[model samples]
Target chain A: MNIMTPTPPSKGRVDVDNFALSYDTLEGPVEAVSNASIHVNPGEFVSIVGPSGCGKSTLLNAVAGFLKPTRGGVTVDGEPIDGPGADRGMVFQQYSLFPWKTVKGNVEFGLKMKHLDKSSRDRAARTLLGLAGLTAFENKYPDSLSGGMKQRVGIVRALATGPKVLLLDEPFGALDAQTRVIMQQILTNMWQRLKISVLFVTHDIDEAIFLSDRVYCMTARPGSIKAEITIPLERPRHQSMMMSSEFLGLRRGLMSLIREESIKAMGGELNDLALDGLSIDLHGQSLADVL
Target chain B: MKVETFALRREQQTATGPEIGAETSHVRTVQSPAGAPPQLAAYLRRWLALNRRGLRAVLIGAISLALFLLAWHLLTENRVVFFIRFTNVPSPSAVYESLTRAMQDSTFFTHVVLSCRRILFGFSLAALIAVPLGLVMGRFRVAHEILFPVMEVLRPIPAIAWVPMAIMLWPTNEQSIIYITFLGSFFPILVNTLHGMSLVDPVLVRAAQCLGAREVSIFREVYFPASLPHIFTGLTVGMGVAWVSLIAAEMISGQFGIGYFTWEAYSLVQYADIALGMICIGVLGLGSSALIRGLGRLVMPWNRT
Candidate 1:
């Protein structure tokens, strides 16, 4: 929160070209991402969606510079991905908060990394926590937090750094369905206010279409972008749009892309959450903010 | 059935031997069966597990002392095992008298103070240096590679073996004792600290790092707290090793410590006095270790689990 010396204005234009990653296990090399090209504009909320084991998370990881691509890699703004640094803040699926640090402490950790004074950090942390409705839980540890609360803490921690882009890897995957919807709405609300580039990965297509400017569908095994569907739904996406036919049709289209990938990739795993019945609730957010 | 399933069945069949035997034994012992006693035993087992090695050791000491006293009284009275000068060895009452006498000696307290000062000095120094250094090595693989090899080469060398070097390097004889004690406990604390540092979750580190913290800041903020449980462990272990090496250090370096006093008693063939001194050392070491463990509990309450 105490970013006293702001970084010389961040460009926030994140781009990936021919991004590839593989892990050479004893069995053989498992190619996680392959020749994946995507661009997230300055303030675009783009979500990458695919079936399980489709390397959507790997794509997010490559953007975060956690994994170096064997062939081509990612570039944030203009700089080449070297090592994991503060320029791209990542929200891990596990809500990887330092269990010892409290919620505010975790949120303020990145700010402190910027070497801001304790007081400034505290103030900024409070503001961010307030935005996420986590101000009351500033001093609570992640272990004490519910799955949704921890994800909120995770988001605050990522956002606290004031990084150019926020990279999320299935952040709400572990939450209950009800909590997931609430968290998604909270995230979208925060994203609307922040206006920062977000590269979110999820297995849920409805979530992808509901929250993104564009949704990138990935292929399995040697993962590459299978399709990029521009979400035509107007923003700020209200709760009403979730019930609208246009939103449902857009959701169906994204699901179809994922279903095709799922059939080929997740051969045996049951797909119980059918396309026809699944619903999205954008919470009570109105059309005033997203645009 | 198939041979594979038949073999599996046979293995499973033999697994119930202990339970079956216990059941049969219970049947023979009691006219009727009740589950109460076994359940009570399980509760008692869990209770003991919660108390740990210190409590177990204390119980053993009490039992051994009781048995030893009972045997001493019996043997001396009946002359069951005729003594080669039972007077010199002393009976339980005589030993008590000797203990009192030793306590009354002004020189005895001096020895204790001197030994304690040496131990505190040596162990504290070891802890202060090893904790930070080990933390550095543990947190970074590069640091681990750079520093661990030298530490490994030095770790196997006994603390007592440093006596000659300590004496030569330091001007004062007391300095030698402190050095010896420091070296004795250094590696255990270092190793444990390193273990504590090394085992801190990488996710936690990254979580901190990606927030905007520099690499150095990550080590300071994340690695330090995460490594505390291990660091405290190292402190406890280092204290233990330091105590073990303290006597050797005192004997070599002190003109007036517990070790020297014990040695003097031995040279004079005062076996009963020597035994008393040995008991005092055991009591002192046990007390100090308990203190460290208590301190650990205060600082890292999470470890109690």
Candidate 2:
């Protein structure tokens, strides 16, 4: 992928090569992401899934140019990322919509920054808001919206700028399970319509498999890419696909990979010694048996 | 799992169907009706229901105040002298009579107006200077570092303590009084503005950046509006302090103001007038603080409820 392909010039190709990041703490320097490399082809949806504190968000932030990589670099369409720009849009898990601005105002923020005229900004905001089923709430402040609605607005606000790449950092993580599933559907629908490359980060295995064409599984802290698994599931995927044998197989594989890394991340905190007390309290029978 | 699928299906139906428009129109019709008299009645009912708790609170406050006034009337009218003497204090009726007399006198309005002018000038000047300075200090580390030490050193000194310096520094007594009032309100506004800036969520800033906001736009669009509620908090507090400092300054150095009127009454041994002046000061202070809260509500519509 690093080799300059003479193929047609397609935009939104993200490339992170051997990216590493570290930050200083009172005790010492802490390594966050270590030599992690990943890519999302133009117009493709990709996700990064890993155990907690696995630096998946760190990698995403670096790509967004909020933080600089300590080792290698991040590039989109062969141009190195110097800082955050209009070319990339990001949706945060916290639904960081400006409370002071109404829903339409929040969505039109990027357009305002671009100096788009009033009529165009309004038109663009309304169209995108309509797609997200938030047209009714365009005049309301973000504080009045539900969690799902707020994240949907977050996505709409990010997309309003007409960016080539969309970056989402656990966008549905704070939502309930049902909202999460519905949000995934809405996100995929938006992705298909916009035809923008996406780099998504989440800890949910089912979410990763459902949303991405390729999923990058990262190891625990001082995180590095452990595997890059491809999902052969057809497009226009549905909630029912989750029960399909193919989907379950992919889920099982990703789960085991993540489970191993999660246990390792706990660092002997969940070893046999921890279970020794449980067995003893249950009168020499397993806890499940006693129950 | 079944529930998840059911919810997802329902959401998809809502997303694609004409249900959204119908739902919105349904909400709109419920919120407002077209019939004039019926709508007015419904509005009145809703308003009454909403303010029922507030009405109870106001009733309680009024009763408490009336009881306190009754106690004052009893103590002074009877000239009670147990542990504390009420012999020299004027009764509430005497104070009310004095207040009625003062209201008829044109010079009493002059005293009230003069004092109001001083407060307005001083508090406005303080807010004008402090709000911007606080924003700058909060946003920039270098500004904070340079100004913080100086502010800390100066803040501990009460506004009353500045009266001597203010009188010496300014040519006119009016300017000196205003200066004292300014000093009283400035620090709270500045400190609270700084606090408001710090309290802004960093995630919002990053979100703005990703949305392609430049530095100036970020500060204007995000920082300024985000810190407004805090700035209003400062303004409300500063208004109270402004009144306190203004009264003290007037009493010490003024020839014609409410504070001076109260002092002159004390010197003249018109005990009833003294109580009248005290009541006047209390009413003015309460009114000004209420004005600040009203302005806060006006500016921050999102903060309502």
Top TM-score model:
2
lDDT of 1 at A52: 86
Worst 10 residues of 2 chain B by lDDT: B29-38
State every prediction's TM-score relative to the real structure: 0.74, 0.89
Any residue pairs clashing in model 1, and if so which?
Answer: A110-B211, A113-B213
TM-score for chain B of all predictions:
0.73, 0.84
DockQ of each candidate's interface versus the true one? 0.37, 0.74
Mind listing the fnat for each candidate? Answer: 0.73, 0.84
Interface CA RMSD of each prediction in angstroms = 2.3, 0.7
Off by over 4 Å in 2: A1-9, A25-28, A272-291, B1-51
Global CA lDDT computed for model 2: 0.91
Query: What's the lDDT for residue A89 in model 1?
Result: 85
Shift in Å, residue A78, candidate 1:
4.2
Error (Å) of candidate 2 at residue A212 is: 0.9
